[model samples]
Target chain A: MTHTVLVTGVSRHIGARVASVLAADPEIGRVIGVDTAPPPSLSSDGGVPLGRTEFVRVDPRGPDIAKVISAADVDTVVHMSLVSAPPRSGGRALMKEQNVIGTMQLLGACQRSATVRRLVVRSTTAVYGSSPRDPAVFTEDAEPAEPPAHGYAKDACEVEGYVRGFTRRRRDVTVTTLRFANFMGPGVDSPLTRYFTQPVLPTALGFDPRLQFVHEDDAVEVLRRTATEDHPGTFNVAGDGVLLLSQCARRAGLVTVPVPSSAFQLMGELARGAGLVDFSPEQLRLMRHGRVVDTTALAAALGRRPAFSTATAFDDFLRARDIAGGLPAALMDLLTRAVAR
Target chain B: MSDVDRRVAELLALLRRRVTGEYEVDEFGFDPELTDKVLLELVRPLYRDWFRVETTGMEHVPADSGALVVANHSGTIPLDGLMLQVALHDHHPARRALRLLGADLVYRLPLLGHLARKSGHTLACREDADRLLRKGELVGVFPEGFKGVGKPFSERYRLQRFGRGGFVASAIRAQTPIVPCAIVGAEEIYPKIGDLRLLARALGLPYLPVTPLFPWLGPLGAVPLPSKWVIGFGEPVRTDEFDPADADDPMVVFHLTDQIREIIQQQLNELRLRRGHAFPPFF
Candidate 1:
């Protein structure tokens, strides 16, 4: 039976890719892509092709979202609009409103729909707040020792709670929550990516936390798998290994200035307020004590393994960043010469 | 080239490799080369010249495959674990790297925690232990934990209760051997005469030990006493003989745990008998 898949947040890269891949599949009958704004169409960085797609301009938070879902008779709902960063200059509050209210409204729509069989929600590992008391690795069953205090992580935790409630009410729907680790790739833009772009990364003094990353391709593939396959329940999606914050900075060729924790937090706040970067308190907590998620369930239950390990993902990110930044080869040669002298 | 130039060149090369993402780091973020260059080099003097650790029954350590080295914990600073790592890494026939299971406090400390991870020390939990052993890595466990490390000078070398025999269950689950190990002289390194409980609570330390030198002598006094050390390994007690389901049996776990603890206590006693002085001026 061909599935009528309705993908939310088509304007976003991963969501667009998910839509594009599903639309191309022979098994999928029709794809319905929905977003508030039309996706970018520039050839160089154009959105992924939504082949045989019926584009619907509808806000997930609005009542119109229900009409779109009901009219399409969608069998699958892939909720991808849960924003990790401020999509535009809307600031954090707007993003939170979009995430929480949007998820609530969309789930309501899915519940109302009789045809919806599968629900794939894109959650994040940030739900597992970084704390000194946290276990070395968090399995799917492990509760967040300290709930995320603020920002996207908080929103994610709330979103998962809503998803759980939805699963109980609509027991027929297969709910797969993919809590992705800090994702990075050639084209991926995230808070971590922005943090690395800085010339001098200010690290917390005396603290070097272990970090994990999933390659953009791996993340997209995992998202695709949940949407396409029959895997149910929560899965912590991440690449195989971990990297140190210091190691990440070193690999990026950025000079690290170890600032005291209080001072570092103050600087981070200033940076975030100035819109110089996206530095949330949750990110600071992450830097203080890194969180690792166990992906044994992803392999065992989901029957999928990421192609790139954490270290390799980080390496690729650095390589892509260098090429993207257009760091001159001559500058490296000049630095080498000066150092030799 | 001069020794300084060669050393600098080697360091520079290592830095380049690290920066260029050539050097491999393991799943736990363990950089073997970096740990060797930095941590091993720093601990070499203390292991070789200072503590002067003498090892025996190292043949008990399997040439390959996973083995859990259950040892007694001592020393106010808990330097015994690091020294044990050095011993196995340097002395074992296969030069096996000991993946020590450290206390939570070790990972709570800032700079120290990062180094511990890079040096292949993970949180002393069964999940990590089970995984490491299954991967065929030799693991070290100090079951006595803080009770052993923070015990008073008068109670030095006295074994503490091994918490619930979690490590034994892990060994059984992994179907690996438990190599009982004991290290004497660590207890004398920083004899904990008293514990500043109030200060420790305020500072978030397990215990603020008041040694003869520490606080009184300041930072200089923090240097460990160069006591003669002996690390004795016992024959590997095979856990493979038992059914895997027996790991859940508390009776079996407790019995095996006591057996290993007794072996370590016996080794410590033997080493103590041969020791001449606490801090002999010359070896």
Candidate 2:
């Protein structure tokens, strides 16, 4: 297990934790963290400490990462830098460059580095773009019902394509792509987390798409476990079970206003414009047709189940929020009893 | 407490569970609690009173485990599936939930799609059907799809192409028995007299049906006729008798599909004759 690992996206929560955890492993001799900005000190996002990880700032636009990969003699590369949405600071263009081109540079570097034996790329289930034609449950091999056209989904798809190309070029490298479901935890700040935590959720009219979740703790655990070992090929990583958006709103004590699908996207933009939330088109379609992936392949590869199911993960997320509205608990209780009879 | 009090207490406890989100659904988003408590209760009236649906050969439905119920699809609006669901739930000895495989259009709609999934139904794709059968669920399929549903009123009960025999392949792969079911009287519910192609095209619907009272009568015509119904489940056609590899053989799939189609068609004719007029009392 003695290897020099180069971890990308060290600036983000998941990357920082993965780099920190891998650095802590005694068998792993060195960890080189690469990012545009320096690692956040004593990160409060999740309180994960950056342990003995040596940070290296390199411009993602250029071929500088290639130099770092070869010079550090990095044997294992953990590419966790892909962004799901255009960040508030960096808009869509910048986000796309960092996700797509940045991945290309990193994979090209990994391809040239003969020492790099294993590669773990963090992917999203969003690649399986939402549509009415989708199956009830998506297997790893299942194609997206509606192929992504733009935004973060297209970026993720392109990144996966480069990974596939790299796998073909570097046959010796064991590539593992983990397509994760919506990340839900108290510490996580995802598009879905923000959407769910809102006081009033504007759901797509008449659509209660089934959604799955992966807890932040379990997400870090999966990344850490795979970074150390070899789990070749793509796997859909998520907790067992699913939750309807309506059910989620009810459980979280939030009132939902159903907007027609025609107006849902516009409404999302209006909310975004109001500076209430960062609502992207990808997120909008996702809300309209919720995505759920099969996690049996993940369990088989990891040899264990995720710590939290979708329902419990959601409840865990709800515990941290100030649940202030919606129907009173007593009223819900009374109604349920009346309906049960 | 007496028996009445005990039942009341149990209902209250279950209601409390519902409020707390303490129920579970399978990976396919099938909520057994919601399906049994809410959905089944909603459709019970249509089965018991509206259509007065009667059943026969329910013994053929496996008491436990996987079985594929292949039935003829008819009626302009496709309410037969709902009535069939209610019938199986109430009449089956085990009261098993029949997980139907529906057309993509069923899911394309908004509120309708949500309720459909909560009621334990899924897309009519082979993978979903295969997974459901493998899990030992009583999977239901209407192979004729829009073809059977949109057939002319004069040609009602005439079977349509089952579409590549995908259902047969799914059942064979899962090694489940196929229970050929026939539902009479649904064809009379909304008799398709004409199809407005231009209107359907604009609406992006498969077919804009023109029933006697529909279109002319507007919303009033949307109401389904309360026709007498009979659902007969035939003997199970065992797929396990053949090797699972048989699922890959196109000829085997075609033969099985054709055989099931013939059985359901014949069953439909006999059941319709037994029930006499679709709208009358004297049989």
TM-score top scorer: 2
Q: Which whole-number lDDT from 0 to 100 does residue A45 have in model 2? A: 47
Clashing pairs in 1: none
**Structure candidate 2, residue pairs in collision:** none
lDDT of 2 by residue, B189-255 (tens): 8888999999999999999999999989989999888999999999999999888899999999999
Q: TM-score per model for chain B alone?
A: 0.94, 0.95
Interface RMSD for candidate 2 relative to the native interface: 3.2
Candidate 1 lands at a TM-score of 0.91
lDDT per residue (tens digit) for residues A179-241 in model 2: 989888876877788888777889899898888999877988998888888889998889888
- The C-alpha interface RMSD of every prediction is 3.7, 3.2
Task: Give, for candidate 2 chain B, the lowest lDDT window spanning 10 residues.
Answer: B13-22
Candidate 1 chain A weakest lDDT stretch, 10 residues: A323-332
